[model samples]
Target: MARILIVDDAKFMRLTLSNILQKGEHHVVGEAENGTQAVEMFEAEQPDLVTMDITMPELNGLDAMKKILSNNPKAKIVMCSAMGQQKMVVEAIEAGAKDFIVKPFDESRVLEAINRVLG
Candidate 1:
């Protein structure tokens, strides 16, 4: 099972993602409420994958992705975007995010993205 990190500003979103990942048989290594915490937890937890919300406070997903990637270029990051954030999603991919999942999370898509990234 891959160690996964869930990063989102909403507690409910984090919990929902955690439940899904757990059901998928992946371990939820850490949960971060914002981008800063995401970066810090990434360092501490060293999770195999990260599901990062695009619009978080302090630091956005793209910036945090950059930070993590800078430290570890092989970091597998998946951007979680809400609708109408296509531009940001594209930017994230360009900025080193391995893949992305749109909001109103779907279990299948989430797992698919993670599998694709990890593979």
Candidate 2:
């Protein structure tokens, strides 16, 4: 299983994602509370995959994704989105995110998206 870094402003959301990925046998290397932290964590940890939320304080997921990709094009990412963030989703893909998961998350869908992106 791949090593994964989870990024979300909400602590519970990050924990939920951690639990889901850990159960799926992916190593949860770290968690980030905001997009700026996400980018820093990604650079330091260099995990096999990252699950990033689209909206956050300091910097949004798309900008974080761009920074990460700018540093490492091969870095893999999946955006954690909310309903009706289609525009952000497109921006994420363009920024080099491999996939996305919409919130209020379904565990199965979360796992599926992770697998599709990093499996």
Candidate 3:
């Protein structure tokens, strides 16, 4: 099972994702409410993958992804965005995100993206 770090400002979103990951048998190493926390948790946890929300209070997912990638070029991060955020999603992919899952998340899709990235 992959160790995953979940980053989202919304508590419900984080909980939903945590449930899905746990049900899928992946270990949740940490959860961060913002980009700053995400970056710090990433450094400390060194999870196998990260599910990062695009729009957050601080740092933003794109910038956080950039920072994480800069620290570990092999870091596997998947962008999580709401509907109609295609532009930001594309930017994330171009910046080295392994894959993306749209919110409100589909359990299968979320697991698929995570598995693909982990693979």
Candidate 4:
């Protein structure tokens, strides 16, 4: 099971993703409430994967992903976004995000994306 970090502004979204990851047998190494925290946690925890929310208060996922990738180009990050945020999602992929899951997440899709990224 891959170690994962969950990053999101909404507590419920983080919790939900945590549960899904746990159920998939992945270990959640940490949870970050904003992009800044996500960057710090990524350095500290060094999880195998990161589920990053596209929009956050401090720095935003795109920037956070950039920061992490700058430090570790191999960092595996899967972005999370609400429907209609397709543009950001594409940008994230172009920025080196492994994959993305739409919000109001589907368990199967979440697991699938994470697995693919981990692989």
Let me know the TM-score candidate 3 reaches against the reference structure: 0.99
The segments of candidate 1 whose C-alpha lies over 4 angstroms from its true place after superposition are: none
What RMSD value applies to candidate 1?
0.6
lDDT agreement with native, every candidate: 0.94, 0.90, 0.96, 0.96
Taking all chains together, each candidate's TM-score versus the true structure is 0.98, 0.95, 0.99, 0.99
TM-score of 2: 0.95
lDDT per residue as tens, model 2, 16-106? 8888888888999999988899989998999999999999999988898888999999988999899999999988887688998999889
Give residue 4's lDDT in candidate 1 (0 to 100). 97
Residue 87, candidate 2: Cα error in Å is: 1.2
Clash counts for the predictions, in order:
0, 0, 0, 0
Model 1 lDDT tens row, 4-44: 99999999999989998888889999999889999999999
What would you estimate as the lDDT of candidate 2?
Answer: 0.90
Candidate 3 lDDT tens digits, 1-119: 99999999999999999999999999999999999999999999999999999999979999999999999999999999999999999999999999999999999999988988888
* Candidate 3 least-lDDT 10 residues: 110-119
Better of 1 and 2 by lDDT: 1
lDDT of 4: 0.96
